[model samples]
Target chain A: MTNRWGLPHLGYGVGLRTVHYAEILSRWPAVDFFEAITENFLDTGGRPLHILDRVAERYPVVLHGVSLSIGSTDPLDLDYLAKVNRLARRVKARWVTDHLCWTGVAGKNVHDLLPLPYTEGVLAHVARRLRTVMDFLERPVFLENPSTYLQFTQSTMTEPEFLSELCERAGTGLLLDVNNVYVSAVNHGFDPVSYIDALPRGRVVQYHLAGHTDKGTHVLDTHSTRPRDEVWDLYAHAVERLGEAATLYEWDEDIPDFATVHAEALKARGLAAGIHREEVAVA
Target chain B: MPEPLTLDLVERWMQTVLVHPESAEAGIQSSPARALIDPGRVSEVVLASGHLTVAERLGIYQEMYLLRMRDALESDYPNLARHLGPHRFWHFVSDYVEAHPSRSYTLNRLGDHVPAFAATWGKRKERGLISDLSRLELALTRVFDAPEDPPVSPEALARLTPEASTELRLSPVAAFALERVRSASLRLLDSPEREVVPREAVPGSRHVHVLFVRKGGQVSRRTLEGAEGHLLEALTSGIPLGRALTRLGRRHRTTRPCEVESWFREWVEEGVFSAASLDPDP
Candidate 1:
C-alpha cells in the first residue's frame, strides 16, 4: 500500500473534531491516525496547541488545512507557509493537505472552498503555485477535489483530467475524496466511477469519505451525516483502483459521538479487506 | 461576442458575485460584478443544469458566504451573539465582515475587530454592556492564543532582599492586564450561562480593573481595584517595584505600604511575572 512517494498507508481514521476533544483525551480511542484542521492550530499557542501536543505524543496526526488557497490568484503567503511548516515539524505530521479550490481574492478570505475553472491556464497557474508551496515546506502536499455546485463554460477539460494533469505538473499527491467525486458527479451530470478511474492511482495517498446534503438539484459537501450508500460504493471503487490509502471519515456538524464516528470509519476496513482478498485470489 | 473569458476574469467575476451583499442576480448587476463582466454575459460563462439556471447556480455561493462568516463569528463571540439574538447577530455579522473581512490565513483571527466594532453599536440601548462583554470575550480569545511563557516561581520572589525587591524588574505573561471593567459586568461572565442574564444598559460604571493570565492552558481572570490595580499595571508595564509603588502611593493616597507588600506576594504566588531582574542603578 505504498503511494508514489512511498508515504505510509495509515489505515482508517476520523477527523479530530472539537466536540470529541475531551473524550479523546480521557478515553484515547483505538484509531490508527487523526486528521487535524491546520488553520485551527496555526494562530493559537494556548489550549488548542496544548491539546494537540498531547495528542501528537500518542497518535499519528496529519495536518489538513482549509485556508491554504493554493489555487488563489493572490500571491503566495510566505508567512502563512512558514507557520504551517513549523507546525508540521512540531507535531511531526505525516503530510499536509488542502483542497484544490481558491478561497478568496484581492487579499480578503471568504473562507469557502470555491471552485476553479478547469482550463489549461488554470492547471498551469495552480501547478506553479503548488510547486512553490511544496518547495517552501520541503514536502509534497496532497490536494483534494472540491464538490462543486456549478461548472464554468470556460472549462475545456473534465474535473478528473484537470486534477490528474495538475498533480503531474506540480509533483504533488491526490487525497481522492470519494464523497466529493459523488457530489460533483451528481451535481454536474458525470459518472462517479469514471471520475475515480481517471486519477493517477499511484499519486493517491489518502481518501476522504463524508456525508452530504442532497438538495434535489445539487449536493452540498456539508460533512454533516453518515456517508450515503452511493458514496460508500464509490469508496469501494477507489480502493479497488488505488489499492490502499489512509481513509478518513468526516462529520463536522451535528456530530453524534466519537464512538459513533469511529464505528463509521471502521466500515472502510471491510471494503479494503474485500479488495485485498480479491487480489489474493487473482494471485 | 466579446473576447473569450480568461481564467483570471472568470475568477474575478465569480468572486464579485459571491461576495455581493444582495442576491446573485442582483450581485451580477451590481457595479463590482459589472466592472469585471457584463450581467447579460453571465450565461455565456456558466453552464446551466436541469431546474437550476446559471444565476441560481452562482447564487449557491452567495448564500453560503454569509453562513460561513456567521459561523466563524458565532464561535468566537457566543455570548455576544446570544445577547443580540440570531436576527440582530446576523445583521451585525454582515456589517462587521463587510467592514473588516478576514485578512489572515486563519478564521481564528476573523473576529479580531469585533470588540472595537461592538463599541460603535450606539443605536442599541445595551450597547455599552455589549461592548464590555465583547471586550471580555476578546481578552479570553487573545489569552487563549497568546504565547506560553513559564511564570516565575514564588521562591524567586522570596530570594530577593528589601534592597533587591525595590529594584526588581518584572515581565508579565501575555494578556497581563485587560481594561478596567464594572464589577457587575465582570460578574456576568461568572454565570453558568451568560446569555440568560439580563442585559445591562450601562456597564463599567463601577470601575474595577481586571487581570488576565494564562494558567495551565486556561485563561483565568482576577479583579483588582485602586492601588492593587495601579500597582499590577505598573509592574506589568516594566516599572521597577519601588517606582511603581511610589507612583501608586502618589495617585492613591489611601494605599498603605503594608498592603502593597501583601499584594506583591499574592501576584508572585499567582505566577504573574514571567521573569524578574534587579533594576540597574541610575
Candidate 2:
C-alpha cells in the first residue's frame, strides 16, 4: 500500500529524544528512522538542533508536529507554518505529520491536542485548510489520529470515518497511530480493529506505537513507558493490514536510556516479520 | 433556526473551557463558552463517556494544561524551581500562566515573560533574588535558542590594525547575551549543587554585570565589570572600536588605553563576536 508520493518504508524507529542524545551520539545505534517533534526543534538554534543535524546525517528522519492546530478556526499561523516547512526542508524529512486535532483558538495556544467534531461542515473546513497547508508546504501533509478522551455529540461520524473522508478530500496522507486508535476506541467504547479496517488503505504512510496509562476507566496517552501488550497486539494487526510503512515508538516522559527505548522500538520488527509470513501464507 | 454548532463556536467553547484557570465547570459557564453553547447544554455539546461526564472529561484537559505548562517552564528554569521548592514553584507557575498564557506555538517561548512576572510576583522577602535568578535563566534560554552563528576566529582579531580601529565594526555572537544580576543569586545558580535555602543565608544583592556566551555547545557565564562591560556593550551597540575606546577613556580617567586593547583581545578569544568588519558605511 504505497502512498501517492511513494515514500519508502524506513522500517522500525524511535523518536529522537533529548534524554538519549549522549548515547545516540556515542553509540550511533542502528535504528532505521528517527521521528522528531518538529516544534521542539523549530525555535531552538542550540544543542538540540545541533544534535538533530548530526542524527539526520546518519539515518532517515521524519518531522511530527503538535502545534499545527489544523482544525482551529483562527486564521492559520503563517509564521509557524513557514518554520515547520523550513525545518522539514532543512532536515530533509521524508514526510511531515501532525495530529488530527486542534491545539487552541482565539490566538492562544492550550498546547494540548483537543478533539474535533466529526461532521460534514467541520470536515469540509478542515479539508480545505489541510489542502491550503499542503500547497504552501509543497508536499502532501500527513495527519495522525490523536488519542481523544471526549467525543462531541455534534460529531456525525466516527473518528475513523472522519479521517478517511478528510484524507480523501484533502489529498493528504495518514500516520495511523495504533496506540491512539486503541486508546480512543477503548475510551469511546468502539472496536479498535473495526476502526483500523475503516481507514483508507493507500493513505496511511506511517505508524506511531506508544505507551499509555490505562486509568482503569479512561486511558491517557502519556507516552511515558513501553507500549503495553494490547498496543503491541494492535501494532501487529496494523502491520498485517497496512503492510509496509515507517513505524516509530514514542516515550516522552520518564524516558530511559537509548538502549531501552530502542529495544522497545525494535519489537516492531517481530510484527513486520509476522506480516511477511502472512503474505507467504496468502500466496 | 438556532445557530448550528459551527467550527468557530465549538473551538471557542473548548478553548474557553480548557484555558480557564479554575475548574472546567467554571470555564463552561464563563461568558465566552456560554455565549457559544448554553452552560446547561454542555453535555449536548461534549458527549460524556460512561466513567466521566462532559465536565469531568473537560477537567482532564483542564488539569493537564497547567501540568504541561509547568513541565516546559521547569525545563527552562530548573534552578528557579529548585530555589522556590516544589509547592511554591507550582503555585508560581499557576499564577504565572494565568498572567501570561502561551501566545506562541513553541513552548520555548512560554517563559519569555517569567522574569518580569517574577519581579512582580507578590511582595516576598526573596522576590528580588528570585527575579534576578529568573532573569539569568531567561537569558540562558534565549541564548540557547538564539541563532547559531560561528564565533569570529582568532586570526580575524590578530589581523586588526590599530589604525583600522576607527572603521572597525563588531557584531556580537548570535548566542550571546548581557545580564545585570545580583551577585548572591549568581553564585547560588552557578554552584553545581543547588538547593533551596534561607534568603539571608546568601549575601550580596549588589549589582554585577554578567556575559553569557554559548561556546563548545554549552551556555556559560563570565563576570564583567567597569570598562569590560562598557566596551562590550559599546561593540554590541554598533559603536566603532576607536569611538568606544575613546568613550571608555573619557569615563574612566584611571583606566589605561592598554586595558581596552586587552579587553578586545579577551573578548575575541572568548568567542564573543560573530563577525568583525571595517564599516565605511556606518
Candidate 3:
C-alpha cells in the first residue's frame, strides 16, 4: 500500500457511469474513489471530459480499458495506448488496467475477452509487451485475470502461475478479478479457493467485484446485476490474501441506480474490513 | 519446432472467430473433454486442472462477441435499429461485427462501422434507416465528444460589419447535416423516451432534414429549416464565410446581411464553432 501509485490504499470503489455521475459528485457519497472506464472519457473533449474533471475534484480516478488488447499481437496500438497514457496522466490515475485476455488483433476488436494459452512463450510475450506499456505510460500498470470461456491445449502455466510470473517479470501489479476467478473456475471446473491461493498475493494492488450470469454449463461476466453469494465468498478470500487495496464493484450491464451499485460497494467494503482485521491478527 | 502462439496471435484469431465462424471450430476441438453443469463453483479453473471440454465454455466467447457489440450500437443507432426491426437489425449488427469489430478502446468508437456497413444492406436502403438515421446518431456522437468551443461572443459579433461577417472563418463544430430524403420519419429518434417509440411507417415526403446536438452531457436533435440545413452543409464542407452565405442566397442572401447576421448569432451561441477563422477566404 505504501508503494501504491495514483490510487493507493483506497478502500472500496465503484466504476463511474453517467447514470451515477450526479450521485457521486452531488451527494459526495461516503466512498474512497471511483474507477472509470478509460474509453468513455478518451477522445471525448466535451461534457464527458468536463464530468471527469468534476469527478476528479472529488475523488481519485483509476483507468480501466477493455480495448488495450494487451494480449493481442497487433503491435501495441501505440496511438490508442498513447491516448490512454495521456488521459491517465490528465486525471492522474493511480494505476490503469486491462484484461489478461486479448480483445482483438489484425485490425478488428471482437469486444470479448478471450483467454490465451498459458505457456512459457506466451508469458514471455506478455512480459515484454507489458514492460513496453508501463514504459510508455511512465507508470506501472495492473493486469487483471480475465473470466474466460475457452482453454487451449498448448497452455503450460496455471492461471496463478502465469499472473504471478507476469507481475514478477514485467515489474507490474495484479488486478485480481475475484468474480472472474469465481466465474472462470466454475465454468471450467476447478477450485476457486485454490485459484485464490495460487494468486500473486504481494503484487496484487486492487480487486474488481462484479456479478455474472450462470449459463448452466458456463458462466458469463455480464456485470449487469448484484454480486452473488459465491462471488462474495471468493472476494473474502481475495481480501484475506491481498489485504485492503483499491476494489471496484463493476456493474457494466443493466447497471442499476447509483444507490444499487453503491449498496454492492458497501458489501465489498464490509468484506474488505473483515479481511483487513484478519490480516492484522495474522501479522 | 512447434512454437506456441502468443496472446497477441490468439487475440487476432479470436477477432476472426467473431466474424469468421470458421475460427470458432478451428481454435479448439468440437466436444468438451468433460461435461460441466455446476454454477456454484464460480472461481475454479476446470481447464487448468486438466478439463479439456473448454471449447464449449468458449462458446460464450462467441455469443457475447455479438451480443455486447449489438447492445453498444443499438444504444446509439435506435432509428437504424428500429428501421431494420429486431430480426433484420440483428442480422446487420451480426454481419457488420463479423467484418468490423471495434478497434478503438472506447465504446464511443464501436458504432463507427454501422454507417459504412449500411451501404451494403438493401433493407437498410429501402428502410432509409442506414444512411439517414446512422448519420444522425454518428453526428450526435461526434457532437457529444466535439471540443467545447463556446459560441462566438457578442463583442466579436458587434465588432464585425456585414461585409466582414461574410468572409469570417468558422470552426467545424458548428456542423450542419442532412440525408438525401423527403421524409420526416428520422425525427422519431429525437424523442426523449426512445425505447417505446414506433420505428417505421410508410415513407412520405421525398426528403428530410434534422439538427444533431450534444448539450449538458446528453445528445439530442432538432429539426432544421430548409435554409439552416443549406447553411450547415456550406459550413461542414469547409466553405468560407462568404461562400456559405452565397450558397444560402436562395433563402436570405448576404446582400441584406441582417437576416444572415441573426442566423450566424444563433449558430455561434449553439456551441457550433470553437472560433471563426478571421482569415477564411471569401
Worst 10 residues of 2 chain B by lDDT: B193-202
Model 3, DockQ value? 0.43
lDDT of 3 by residue, A70-181 (tens): 7767788888888998888888887788888777667666766767878898888889998998898888888889987766756787899899888889877888888999
Model 1 TM-score?
A: 0.94
Candidate 2 residues lying further than 4 Å off, grouped into runs, are B1-3, B190-203
For residues B67-117, write the lDDT of model 3, one tens digit per residue: 677788888887777767888778888787657766666667878877767
| Candidate whose lDDT is highest | 2
Candidate 2, residue A239: the lDDT equals 76
Alpha-carbon shift of residue A170 in model 1 (angstroms) = 1.7
- Give a tens-digit lDDT track for model 1, residues A1-283: 5667777899998898878989999999999999999989998787788889989999999999998898888898999999999999999999999999998888888888999888888899999999999999999998999989999887899988998899889888888888999998988989999888988777788899999998887989899999999999989988888668899999998999999999988999888888889999999
Over B99-181, each residue of candidate 1 has an lDDT whose tens digit, in order, gives 99888888888898887898886466676677777777777778768878888998877888988888988888764555666
lDDT of 1 at A142: 88
DockQ of each: 0.74, 0.78, 0.43
Mark the regions of model 3 whose C-alpha exceeds 4 Å error after superposition: A4-7, A278-283, B1-14, B21-55, B124-129, B174-181, B191-204, B215-220, B250-258, B278-282
Return the top candidate by DockQ: 2
TM-score of chain A of each: 0.98, 0.97, 0.95
What is the RMSD, in Å, between candidate 3 and the native fold over all Cα? 5.6
